[model samples]
Target: MVAVVTALVLLVFIASFRFYARFLGRRIFADEEPGFVTPAHELEDGRDFVPTKRPVLFGHHFTSIAGAAPIIGPCVAAYWGWLPALVWVVLGTVFMGAVHDYGALVVSVREKGRSIADVAAKVVSGRVRLMFLCFIMVLSWLVLAVFAMAIAGLFMAVPTSVLPVNIAIVVALVIGWLLYVKKLPPLLPSLVALVVLYVFVWVGTKVPLDLADTGLDKDQVNLTWILALFAYSAVASLLPVWLLLQPRDYVNSHQLVVGLGLLFLGIFVAHPSFDAPAVRMSGDDAPSMFPFLFVTIACGAISGFHGLVASGTTSKQLDKLEDARMIGYGSMLGEGALALASTMAAVAGIGLVGFCALPGQGPVEDLSWAVYYDNWAHASGNKAAAFVLGGGAFLQQLGISAVLAQTLMAVLVISFASTTLDTATRIERFIIAEIGDALKVKALQNPYVATMIAVLPAIVLATMRVADGDGGVREAAWALWPVFGASNQMIASLTLLVLALYFWQRRRPVLPLVIPMVFVMGVTMFSLVLHLLAFWAEENWLLLGLTVVLSSLILWMSAESLGLFVRLLRERRAAREA
Candidate 1:
């Protein structure tokens, strides 16, 4: 009954959002302009600007944006309750995330496919552009660092996932060759490739490969996997989109759809009741639900990163103006659906395997809802492990073996993270090049040099250490996650501001853009302040400095944009009177 109700609610929200997106596209963006030249057509290059079919472009955009964050965030945020997470996922996607993504795409298309930061230069000021670019660079660094570590962790934690993940890459290369070089039809070949991927999944379960078994210590294993993943990113980032990026994402997109379908189906068949509390409040030390929930569940509901992908890549490949609504707005709703599934799994499935004690916390005699939430809130890695276990439980409901189900779930997570890491690297490469051009540095314009510049910081950060709860140390990824959430939502707010400015310049009603902008700004800023205080108390100077810098940039950019928007509005009024 719970599963049926959840499914119905999600379906209704998704259907309604689709219709609303159409209305916004038609009325707000006027996206139906006939024969408007798209950047793909105007600047068709074999590399990045090639005109793409709607399905292919949507796959690329969705997979790139719908990475491990959506799954990871909601899984952790379910600590507050499934109800809150679900509500935010649905409403945020419909009202905030979709609008941010759609508007960014429209603005970028109008600006010949430049990034939102680039668009900021013309709409806001040159200083705003520089700040926005710096903001994006930092955001990308966090994304790359977090996701690369995530994939490495998954590979180590679920060793059976390694072979399948590697095999999928090889299969993507084959599919890319068929689709681009041989001009083979995509559907049949993609279907075959998916089948091959699953075959590897089954084989991997039979022969799991653990890196620690190869005579390396824990630290050495972590370092090795991190280095291996970034190496893969470097090469993958440099390759042509048709060769690896597009086809690989296309494959992963299918995997996501299939995974979601199975999850929902298993829920319906198993009829798992919600065991976690509908809402839980921890002690005074815990973060409150107001702004923290919004920031904590950042990507599941709304992500500023979606705006980057929309403007950075998707706009350039749009086949038609109308497709912007489908690709941009639609992908966000798709991500919301993923977030919804993750929340359901965490609340319901995790109950099947009673909650365990968090790191540095001794084993409990019995696990309760309060203990579960408390443990997860304290140990980020525990939340990730809990999600994997919960997702595996969902798969087991379909009569799959427990080991196989867990491996499959890990594979799904790794695949999502890998795609995001490589795509972000490529996007960062472009950003680095753009920054170089802004600074008038000729050497940094080369893609290879730019890509190296983009990846090095992430490598350095991922390998950095923070004190582990067990009196040891762990990679900085988990420690950096809170900052990532604040930064991510801040990016979304800045994007909304840019879109609002776009509407204002064109004399369109700015209410749609402005409302979400104000709400997100409030939520993100509040959370940032809380994080700043927390980091200060803990004497974590690095994250403390990051929080301060990000807060300052957001304030600076917002002030400049607001002043310019008012002047623009007044000038427009004066011109109309004349």
Candidate 2:
């Protein structure tokens, strides 16, 4: 019965998203007109703007946006109970995330494939454009920093994932060469690559690699992986889209689909019941769910980061305007599905391990549910570990050995996260170059120079250590995640504001976009204010300053947008009177 409920819920969410997609296509986007030339064709250079087929583009977009966030956020947020997390993931994706992504894609498509920041310049003002650009650069920096640390942590914790991850990169390069250099058909080559990658996953299980076994201290091992990741990002950022970014994501997308299928099948066979509480408060230490929940589960529900991917990279590669609906909105639903799976795993798998109590909360017998989640939340650097253990437990039901199942789960996460890391570096490079153009700085305009500038700060932040409550030091990435979530959600609010302005200018209805914009703005600002108070109390000056900057920028943009809305309304009324 429990398994049946889970399956039904997932199916219903998917079916509803499909219907919403159709509605959006007809009423909002108004369908792609014939003879419309996409930027992929008009600006095709066999590089960033190369025309891509639907499946390949969807794969790239989905994998790029579907990083560890969806998995990690839901895993951690399950502390409030899986029921609330599941609700947010389902509704947020259908209404908020998909709308933001699809709108950004269509608006960018119409604007010659410019980013939402660029569109803000035309629709709002040049000053707004600059502010948005700055906001995005900071957001991207955090993304790169956090994801790099995440992949490094995963590799260190699950060493078997290391070999498969590196091997997948080699496979991607080979696949890139075959598809682009040799002019082979992509379908057959991508399929063959997928098969070979899975074979490698099996090989990885047989011989897991551990960095700690080499006699290095924990910090030293982490530093080694961090440096290795940044070095790879530098090279990957400079490579053409056809070479590394697109092909690698395409392969990772296949792995994600296969992994999800097995997880769901395992759930059915295992019939894992809900183990966590339906709704439980974490006392005064934890923030209430109101704004925190919305921001914590950003990617699964709605994320501003997807707007950057949609406009910054994906729009440039869209072969057809019509495809944006699927690539934009459909990909979000795919991520939501992943989040749901993670939530289910966290709730079910945590119980099997016999440590289900909320952190600092004593165990309670005779509770309705079998597991406690707050305990997992308090386990530093173990959020990802929890998800892996939970997911592995599910896979175990499929007759896989516990060791092999955990390794497979680790490979799935590391591959997804690594795809996000390099892609973010590339996106950050683009933003840096655009900032150069905005500021008229020649040196910064060079992609290589801009990439190095972006990478340096990320590397430093990723490697830097800060003192934790236990008097032990932890990587700065752990400290920055809360701020990252707030900043990320702010970006979503700003993107929605941009979309609202775009729709208003065309005399279209803006209610569909405006409601989510206002709601996200309110929730994110509330959360940021709370974070600001907390950071001040702790004397974390670095994060405190960042919070101030982001808050100020968001407020400034909001004021400017209000002014624009008023002006646009007056002009429309005047034109009607005339």
Candidate 3:
């Protein structure tokens, strides 16, 4: 209840600031010239820099920013208490997340779409740049492996949905090509494609796949498929905007907006009661504490991952730096809103029907590992059934048949995983490429070559997990979660540190950066200790190994920042002397 109230209060505060900040800032600085010129403006290419409508751009940015984590974290954390999840997401977003995301975008645009790695190289030291890249690369590989397993799990649950989603993707690609590459208007074709895709969802649902061969039902992370996916990303990211990434993202963005909108609508309409406690604490309580909370609610609140999107993707497409605040900051707020909506789902999506369907009598015990398969299946079935019926109402109005609606819903879910996979692979490849360059590897000097280096790690990691058998995906996810949370928070910490450093050097107000910097560092450090302690207690060697690696990386990064701080201080002292 406290968390819920806190979340609501912060949400209101951010929403107001997001609306009026730019207007006020613009009015106050009307006489001043633009602070920076984006690379897009200096070297405009219609391909990436084509002026898109604000709403359309918002849709794209929002979709790229929203991913499976928002949904999964909330769902998993719901087992603990929706109140903590909701409060953290809201408060964190307003204070830290929005600033990080918006700042990353604005900074990247001003720097001409150069990535954070490049930013570090220019603003800090080469070592710092290398650290940023290496950290991100590792992050990407973990993300890809985890998402691949997630997709596999979803496929195993309802194998019939996979083909429909794959088919929908192909159809989406065709629509994108015609619209962007062919220079045709996208409105009609996209609409038609969506309608047809919805139809496929309905028909595909009726076309049943035989589950008689239950042995095939088990999800084995096919390394080959994952590698193929990475291989595709290597080629895709290298391709022109008129091709893969742009088109896929465009379609995905539109679908995401619609899906999220409908979901929000459904939430408001159903207004289901919350079954979980407002502030239930974890047994060890370590995982949900300060440091872990920051990491656990990464994207839904503030994520370093968004910097990749802002610099790597969105900045390249900005027609004007003037729009940076809107695209960068506004997009973050939008993401925050999505996270809030997810929190609402976690809090209010459950009903008596869902509770009764569970294996155990109570919420806490129901979420335990001891929960049986029958209970899981029953709950999953009940929840899925309710969603299907609820989703049908909208689908029917959209002219989607009952079966098609289910297929469509499944397609959206699959696409989320697929897009996350491809995007994660590309990001990882970039990270490896940077590391290779740092190590003076000849192959990684070339972007294409570096991407290949990056792809291999993800492929190998995903494959190995698949080989581990039952709950391989789940196991892989658990292994990555702590590291992912830590690295994510570390990135947030770095961003705040950088902002603080920049502001301090400029002799401006440093409170904003200083406050967040200290808070996030506390969060990251706390989470790291918890993870290490858990590993020690359980004697989980894999986790222990992961914690060790992550701790080393964090220390290395911290050292880089401290050195930067000392260098800056000395420079300021010298400036005052002069």
Give TM per candidate: 0.95, 0.95, 0.82
TM-score quality measure for candidate 2: 0.95
Model 1 sits at a Cα RMSD from the real structure of 2.2
lDDT tens readout by residue for model 2, 1-578:
55876787788767866797778777777656788899989999877788888988999999999998998888778878877888888878888898899999998988888989989999889999899999999888888888888888778767777777899899999988997899888888888888998888788877878888999998889889988999998899889898999899988898889998888888899887778778867555667878788888888889999999999889999999989988998898888888888888877765555432232244544222233444434632356655787788789889997777888898888877888888888888888888888999989989889989889999888988876545676667668788889889889988998888888777677788889888988988999999999888877777788889988998999899888988888988999999
Q: Relative to the unseen true structure, what is the C-alpha lDDT of residue 101 in candidate 3, on a scale of 0 to 100?
A: 67
Candidate 2 residue-wise lDDT at 403: 70
Which 10-residue span in candidate 2 carries the lowest summed lDDT?
A: 366-375
Clash tally, candidates in order: 0, 5, 5
C-alpha lDDT values of all predictions: 0.83, 0.83, 0.60
Worst 10 residues of 3 by lDDT: 365-374
In angstroms, how far off is 517's CA in candidate 2?
0.7
Model 1, which residues run further than 4 Å from truth? 354-371, 376-379, 467-474, 572-578
Q: Model 1 TM-score? A: 0.95
The better candidate by TM-score, 2 or 3, is 2
lDDT of 1 at 59: 82
